[model samples]
Target: MAASTQRRGRRIMMAPEELDTFLREARTCRVATVSADGTPHVGALWFVWDGTSLWLYSITRSKRWAQLRRDPRISVVVDDGEDYGELRGVELSGTVEFVGEAPRTGEPCPELDVPERLFPAKNFGLDDMPHDGRHAWMRLTPTAIASWDFRKLGGL
Candidate 1:
């Protein structure tokens, strides 16, 4: 995971610990990918943050999957708060690496164990991951990150 290069709004920037907690508590992230035609596609996904990386479980047959196969570059944003003073968010950008089988059939991969355990427990309240054979994992060890919490501005 590369360090965040955020210079602007330093007062509002989230600390490393705060960023970790925010990502862990946030449920959805908007993923951005480049299409083969040079356009951009954005979609919402439920993701797990492992402190060092972000793991995305996506449908192998979806357009997002197809686009990623063609171009692995991606950017993801997880944000919260409706009010201006309460707003906070994190943005992670990097190329993603496909992990395990394309359509995961629960094949044993040690690299996936942590995320597999964390994802279900966080999202579904389950002890173990339920593999459907249609969804697979993509790991993004971000090259760049930017985060902010407006509350840190002291109500400014």
Candidate 2:
């Protein structure tokens, strides 16, 4: 007797509620990009979910920002907060066009005195600071996104 197998195309769309859960589940993402000299760089970042977009902060002096300065295109990987079971993930591929130090997104950039201002008071302290020239803040706007939650798949 032969056994049948099931294979189906999985769409990468996360429902509004699912997205909220995923975003809340994962607060960190790794930003990846290539430098002007063709060097690869990746940095872990804390992000905020605005329902329609993802926001994060970076110091202009950071290597990640240097690479992004030359290449606006980048990738971000955010994973589920759980340990072994039910791992969900969100992968974002988009351009990192610089909008200057303006607050166009109404999202606060990382600063020495204050965090994104979105998190609770206990989320950050006055220890964070830009290393080099003190860039103050940065913003990354997402153009494309891919996310998956395996809750329905028994943790695929």
Candidate 3:
């Protein structure tokens, strides 16, 4: 006898609400970008999902920034799974647009502080943290998205 596949498809598919909830609670995403020469770079990033787009805060002098400036196309993966049945993830492919200049040498931008506000709260359950460096913020507007939940594969 064959196990049912109804739950399989449903589980793998995240409804709009489920997807938003998962993204809201996720801590990290693997951000992928390409260099001018076509080499690929992937880095784990702390992000904030504001319903419509993902906001990323990064050091202006980092390699990821350099590569992104050269080519803005990017892909991001947010997933977790210690076991097969628990696996769930989302992939967002898009282009990044710089939202604003890096903050002054030792100050924070009140408007672009989502990462500063969210990182601590989500990762450590804290509401605030000292601002770090001259950081720039970028917004990723996803062109396509794909997601899955292995729990759907249950009922076997």
What are the runs in model 3 whose C-alpha is more than 4 Å off? 1-11, 103-120, 124-129
> For residues 121-156, what per-residue lDDT tens digits would candidate 3 score against the true structure?
776788874446566778887877777878777833
Off by over 4 Å in 1: none
Cα shift from native, residue 45, model 1 (Å):
0.3
C-alpha displacement of 151 in model 1, angstroms? 0.8
Clashing pairs in 3: none
Cα lDDT tens digits for candidate 1, 12-59: 889999999999888999999999889999999999999999999999
- Model 2: pairs clashing at backbone N, Cα or C within 3 Å: 72-96
How do these models rank on lDDT, best leading? 1, 3, 2
lDDT of every model, 2 decimals:
0.94, 0.58, 0.77
Measured against the true structure, the TM-scores of the candidates, in listed sequence, are 0.97, 0.66, 0.80
How many times do residue backbones clash in model 3? 0
How good is model 1 by TM-score?
0.97
Best lDDT goes to which candidate? 1
| Candidate 2 Cα deviation (angstroms), residue 26 | 2.5
